[model samples]
Target: MSVNRRSILRTTAQLATLTAAGGLLTGCGQEAATGGGAAASEHPAHPSPTPGAPTVLTPNRIPAATPSAAVSGAPSAESAGASPSAPEQPPLAANTPAEVISGPSDRPQVALTFHGQGDPRLATALLTAAEQHGAKVTVLVVGSWLDQQPQMARRILDGGHELGNHTLNHLDISSLSADQAYAEIAGCADRIKALTGSIGRWFRPSAAQFATARVKAQARKAGYEHCLSYGLDPRDYADPGAEVIQRRMLGSIKPGSIVALHMGHQGTVDALPAVLEALQQRGLSAVTASQLCS
Candidate 1:
């Protein structure tokens, strides 16, 4: 077909594909710097898959950030109110060097990391499924999500899953200025620390799979020793069928690999069992990013 028509068809397909996510998705996302939707300067080899939220928590949760509160580049949310007591955490990631991508190739373990937002019920379902299969995953939550669903912070930890920060508003962190980026990182981190007795362990940049140097620096300032990235991406946030998610994961995942998934979709919840089963078949245990990296 003509180039114009092809472009139109592609756009239409993307729109059609997104229809099912109506009001369901909150958003999150990567593998390398290479391929999905982010600007080339943002991620080079693997483009990010889920590219908004950039927040799907909607405008209802809270202001993406309080501009004034964020100006000092300090976390203001910690003093908001009393937070729940957190459960004992899993073995934390002590490695302070390099980006956390995958684990040692010789080990039979892989990490499943989720961009956490969307319906709490769905998030719970996915977590339950993972736990049932004797798996543990990492959840990098958007700050605003916790504002709306504060209880989830404790619930995630209670389930033996490792919780991390995915920024306060889930914005395109790579595109933000230093102060703004710091606010995003520290903002959510403060919330995590307040709710869970710690800022969790890792920081995964929202809207992008990889963290830019600036983002890494900002995360360090916010108390993260290691930034988390992923080696495998099934694009579960795209609302692709559970089979597609399962197929993509089974086909691409490897030992010591970190797989990126999302918490807001039903397809992801449905795909959990089969994905876990496939991993079991391959003798790979699903673990947290800290577990894999450390």
Candidate 2:
């Protein structure tokens, strides 16, 4: 089932209320992060598999860099001490695909993506669990959130996971004007580049589950090749019971599914062990979105 704009806005409001009441229990970060949704096309384009069988492309590997070093042209040190200049980044490739809904269906692999904004402790816990289970995930971080916890960018990359952009303030890009959308995309990308020495590996629209074509173009101009969208959403943002979250994910996942999850929700953190276990039991491995797409 697709999540419409109205429901997404309502959920955002509910999350805000819960946070203000201190009733929302999130994983180990400073505060609870919220989510937004958008209506999606019934049949968005997906990566095509090879004839007769899915082509298993080797995952692209970018060596993790030191936290002190910048990925782009930003200054290397944010401290008072003298530091070495960061290396310049190579120009990004052009003609990247505008969107990717899922990886090749022939592989027994799924990508788990977390929308980040909430508790760093919880985010660390999730990353640790994924590593323990021989899995990697993609974290789409909000730009403003990164500004609050700049270290998270390095922490995520340090764990062998990939990072992506989720806009500046997590507002719905579809409703914004073209220039506003570009600002959101560029703002987040700037943060990612400043912290990681490169723009994010992907761009997922904020406040909306799927990116509009206009937003996609903006993201492309900002340096992201693919506008990432999920094929499986367990609605972890709703704070369903841990068991429910686990069951829904374990029951719904399929080959090449990109599972959308959230950061800062205790239920999601609690449910992840079982979900990872179930994936392993089924001979499916959890991978980063970039890996799945690659």
Candidate 3:
């Protein structure tokens, strides 16, 4: 799961050169989920299961211009836009990975992240634990949730953790049209920008669902490199009990890990203290997703 700096530099150089050439290089790249090409020409494929862990899946590599055939419903915000007079949400600022602050690597470091609609109680618990432990955790807020819970969103920003965009209404990006997908992403960026006066740089598509090269390209164009998870995830989203959540997280966490847990889950909240304590005992310093990307 660890990609050395030389490899990262090489890939980054290639990506940068490609960007200068126009957009991303057009070609078919295999989807990790099905171990098959996710090109528009191929049929839709499911994400492949991680070795020895049903909950964890392999990381996806973004491809250029390879259109995916996936489909899904429209974002909730667009539907709400039936009234043109609706106030526009603030725009998100651009976040390029080159700007991120790198953290300690000689010592173990992991970023604990929460996904989904932000809940007040869950946010309180997450922020409180992080503050009490001096841990820096990344919170990927849904645009609708942020607009609904502005006060909570403000608290998250005030606390000094990096805020990332998690698309409006949690629609799967693979299912939306290119324009629709860009809107879903850009809308959130705009709203977040309106709130914090900065565009969002890190974007995590709902369900890690980037089915087409176009989807990934759209995200990059919006000033984000699709955030990829480093640590294998345990499915806390399904409401797996607290013990199970803790057990799964503790089982696979390692250095440079991007551990994922869901927000709005009571069980995860309950398990968090134990998880944080374990992280402390193991000397894994917590950080934001942005910090890890660089």
Count clashes in each candidate, considering only residues at least 3 apart in sequence or on different chains: 12, 6, 17
Tell how far residue 128 is off in model 1, in angstroms. 0.6
The lDDT values for all models are: 0.71, 0.68, 0.57
- Model 3 scores a C-alpha lDDT of 0.57
- State the displacement of the C-alpha of residue 217, model 2, in Å, after optimal TM-score superposition: 1.2
> What is the lDDT for 194 in model 2?
66
Which 10 consecutive residues of model 2 have the lowest summed lDDT? Answer: 45-54
Residue 263 error, candidate 1, Å? 0.6
Model 1 bad stretches (over 4 Å): 1-96
Model 2 lDDT on a 0 to 1 scale: 0.68
User: Which model, 1 or 2, shows the larger lDDT?
Assistant: 1
Q: Write the per-residue lDDT of candidate 2 for residues 68-175, one digit (tens) a residue.
A: 222232222253122223323223335335677777789898999988767778888888888889998989887666655677777787788888888755654677
lDDT of 1: 0.71
lDDT of 3 by residue, 1-294 (tens): 357978999999998897866632322222211111111200123121111211211122222111221112112223333222222223322543322223335547787876745357776786777778788777776655655555555566667676777665455567667766665566566555555555445677765623357667777766675544344577776677889989998998877677666666678788888888899899887776655544
User: How would the candidate models be sorted by lDDT, starting from the highest?
Assistant: 1, 2, 3
* Candidate 3 TM-score to native: 0.63
List of clashing residue pairs for candidate 2: 28-122, 29-119, 29-120, 70-197, 71-197, 72-197
